[model samples]
Target: MKKLITLAAIALFSTASFAQTTWNVDKAHSKLQFTITHLAVSDVDGIFKDFTATIVSSKPDFSDAKVSMTANTASVSTDNDQRDGHLKSPDFFDAAAFPTLTFVSTGITKTSANHYKLNGILTLHGTAKAVVFELWYRGTITNPMSKADDAGFQVTGTIKRSDFGFGSKYGSPMLSDEVVVKANGEFSKAN
Candidate 1:
């Protein structure tokens, strides 16, 4: 009986060790940016200057990966001081009330050898909604600069600002409902 209990404990620990590996975002090599049409005429671009993400997976293909990220709302910038201020106000993001926007994956499905569909819930403006994004795994490499194992991925998606409580209250016609978001980054495997 004692031998059987000891063997069972070893098996459990081994399984847990092989079940999940965590990766940390290499922020210097990552970006969280977006673009939106201005007044149905020109394009306006912005980025979240502060953000972080974690990726955990049990498989080499990352089909079982869990991803989560958070971005500081006040970090949004478009190169125009006045416009940036307006975006930080209650009329837009209400950065003071909702200081951060976050997303946590609910599912990850492999679409091809290197492509995947990431389904998750995004919380913004104090509201949570389902969002699906496309991700392309760019494989892994040993970084020439850091000499560390790094994995790369690209993500693209669109979300309606109005769906998250950004509406006509702030003369919404001046801004489009849909915001195009993109992120390409390398993550380092955590020890």
Candidate 2:
């Protein structure tokens, strides 16, 4: 009987080990994007060229995670040179004074099999605000390019520009004070 109990315990421990693997954000292939209203008739989308996050998980508890991200504010690209320049000026992100937007997660909770909620503070434009993003695990695969095990996720969240002390000069009826942010990133086992 004691032998059987020991065997069961060993099996459980082995299962736990295989369930989790470390993932490092492949920043070169990941992207963080934002969209805001423009002129009340169109939408301008921009992407931060560089950003990263760390994700960890355990079986049945995807909530076990540590996420951190750093983005270059000056890398904003709207596909238009002049507009992109304006977005980096004092009237908008003011990239000169506030060079980066960063977030470090406090925790992550699995709301359901397919949905997750991440609690973190977003520091943008020199102000910090507690923010939550609804995140979904897109799935996992073996990357063809790197021939490595990897996973991907999509995270969506919204915050009032004013919440980060960014809307004063840029917000108006045409350019709404509300902005939406999205991140689509993939991570691979870190070497």
Candidate 3:
């Protein structure tokens, strides 16, 4: 009887582990943006036009969700052609040398209902650093058009550009060392 009970418990644990679900970001409804204080007088904003993100979890509340994202460095745009070109050059992102920036969650801690502190490793400009972002799970709903279960989320954080070894020439009043990052996405359940 004890052996049979042990086998049942093991089977239940294995089934729960295999129940992980994956959600893929809907690019049409997502945006990855950043802002930096420029000259201490104005703020400059930009967006990565090419990016992909996913979430994997087994819990209904997504407390155990693991997030991953990758953004194309060359796709950074501030709506100004000259500035965008410069950003892609050796001065800032040096997109040719570092083609992509990626983030993979190491862990997540629930801070409150539908809110979490997401700890992850962010790799930029060939440097990887541990960072934490505030994540808000905006809940899930069935998409009227797609008729699929979709989840919404928003992540916000700040990072020092200097830590990643980028934009060292610009300092203080020229540009702020801190960059504000924000991402919003609608993810559809893949399975």
The pairs that clash in candidate 3 are: none
Q: Per-residue CA lDDT of candidate 1, range 1-191, in tens?
A: 99999999999988986788898998998999999988888999999999999999987778888999999999999999999999999988899999999999999999999899999999999999999999998998888887888999998999988789875574446778898999987899898
- Write the number of the candidate with greater lDDT, choosing between 1 and 2: 1
List TM-scores for all candidates, in order. 0.89, 0.84, 0.92
The pairs that clash in candidate 1 are: none
User: Highest lDDT: which candidate?
Assistant: 3
Candidate 2, 26-89: lDDT as tens digits: 8887889988987787777889886667776654345576678888889989899998898899
Ranking by TM-score: 3, 1, 2
The candidate with the higher TM-score, 1 or 2, is: 1
- By summed lDDT, the worst window of 10 consecutive residues in model 3 runs over 164-173
Query: Is candidate 1 or 3 superior in lDDT?
Result: 3
Candidate 1's displacement at residue 54, Å, is: 0.6
Residue ranges of candidate 2 with Cα displaced over 4 Å: 1-21, 58-61
lDDT of 3 by residue, 126-181 (tens): 99999999999999999999899999999999999999988888986799999999
Runs with alpha carbons beyond 4 Å of true place in candidate 1: 1-17, 170-172
Clashes of each: 0, 0, 0
Candidate 2, run of 10 with poorest lDDT: 56-65
